[model samples]
Target: MAVFRSRFARVLAVIGLAAAMLVGVFVGTASACSCLPGGEGAKYARATHVFTGVVVGRALLSGDPDTAHDDKYRYLVLNYRNHKGSAPALVGVETAVGGATCGIELALWSSYVVFAQGDASDGVVETTLCSGTRLASGGPPVTEEPPTTTTPRPTALGGSSPACPPIA
Candidate 1:
């Protein structure tokens, strides 16, 4: 009876240790994509291109044709400013294929307010879930006010820069 109790105690201890290790592993893993807290205004300041448009089309592009995993999703934007802009009418926006990389999945034919950043190395305009892009249905009502420049403000770390552009 004493031996049985000892074995049972060991088993319970092992199970508890395993559960603790699993929880630790999961908690550490989930810290991969950490975003700082900010509002849409802050997101607008970080973005290079801001537009409201619908996803007219989507396609997967592969760096190597022989590879099975296509790299990213290329979305075609249209139906805005009478389908005209200083940028192309049909702009191709690239995003990672999964949310694990802070990627966004824009539904075809659905409109969204996109806050995109220009990739300096590749020169491609891209957006992510962290960029404050949202469905147009839930976005702020469109106003005709032009963007007004505000006094530059210091960042949390104590550097000054221009304020966010007003949402159109």
Candidate 2:
């Protein structure tokens, strides 16, 4: 009787541990999904103007391989040049595509799109705004040459000279 009782207690402890682990896994997954804009049903709302920046990193693709069809999705890290004069800032977003295959078709670094805009605070641009299908399968678009300007001599000896001063 004593041995049987000990075995029962051990089983109960194992069950409790398993339940705790399951709960932890669920919570972690829920938090990650929630971090995405629009919760689970987020979709593109309207078109908006957005400045383009260079792709500073490679795209990441993920999805289940055991499905009937091997489905995959893409995510990109963009370095957006906030204002006309500021340095580029790094931003990451999940590439929105109808199916896994479409996501794979989109180009990485060299490609630019008018993606559906999202809240600026989150730094995520929804896939909806990605307009102007992929460009040629090569480098990024040609950017206009920055206007040239002549520098003025320093007014005082000890003062710092302005670099890339505004064009008159």
Candidate 3:
């Protein structure tokens, strides 16, 4: 009986440690991506822009080109206005059908549409290749709003740009 009890305690200890480690990893990952430089997730949470760009490519499966992965996966490349306003920067977003995948691996993008949520640091943003239905028929119009006192502030850590610069 004593040996059985000891073994049970050991098993419980291992399980507890494993659970704690899993939680730590999750929290760390969330923090890293929360305000990732050039990541749209953080921008989306801030609600800076209502509509951004248009989707240009068809949704493709992760690995198999022959299969249509629209139901399983969705991705878009967005042409967004940059700070200079000289041209639009293209941002890419690849998201799971559901909000299951969240991490640095997924949040990193070349170009993407950034939507302001509320708080830039803590809010969550949805990054995509294009703005999807958010944009007008001809894409987001060029209209400049006067700099407002309530404008979403720029990211302190230089996150205003995309994770990867547009290739073109």
Highest TM-score, which number? 1
lDDT of 2 at 149: 56
Runs of candidate 1 with Cα error greater than 4 angstroms are: 1-31, 63-70, 79-86, 119-124, 141-168
* Candidate 2 lDDT: 0.43
Better of 1 and 3 by TM-score: 1
- TM-score of each candidate structure, all chains considered together: 0.56, 0.33, 0.26
For each candidate, the alpha-carbon lDDT, in order, equals: 0.71, 0.43, 0.40
lDDT of 3 by residue, 1-168 (tens): 999999999999999999999998877523111234432333333344444445555453464556333233333445455321222234333443433333112222333333422222322233333322233334333334334254343455755543433445
Q: Residue by residue across 91-127, what tens digits does model 1's lDDT show? A: 7888877777677899999998777777424434788
Ranking by TM-score: 1, 2, 3
Pull out the clashing pairs in model 2. 114-129, 115-129, 115-130, 116-129
Query: Hey, what RMSD does candidate 1 come out at?
Result: 9.7
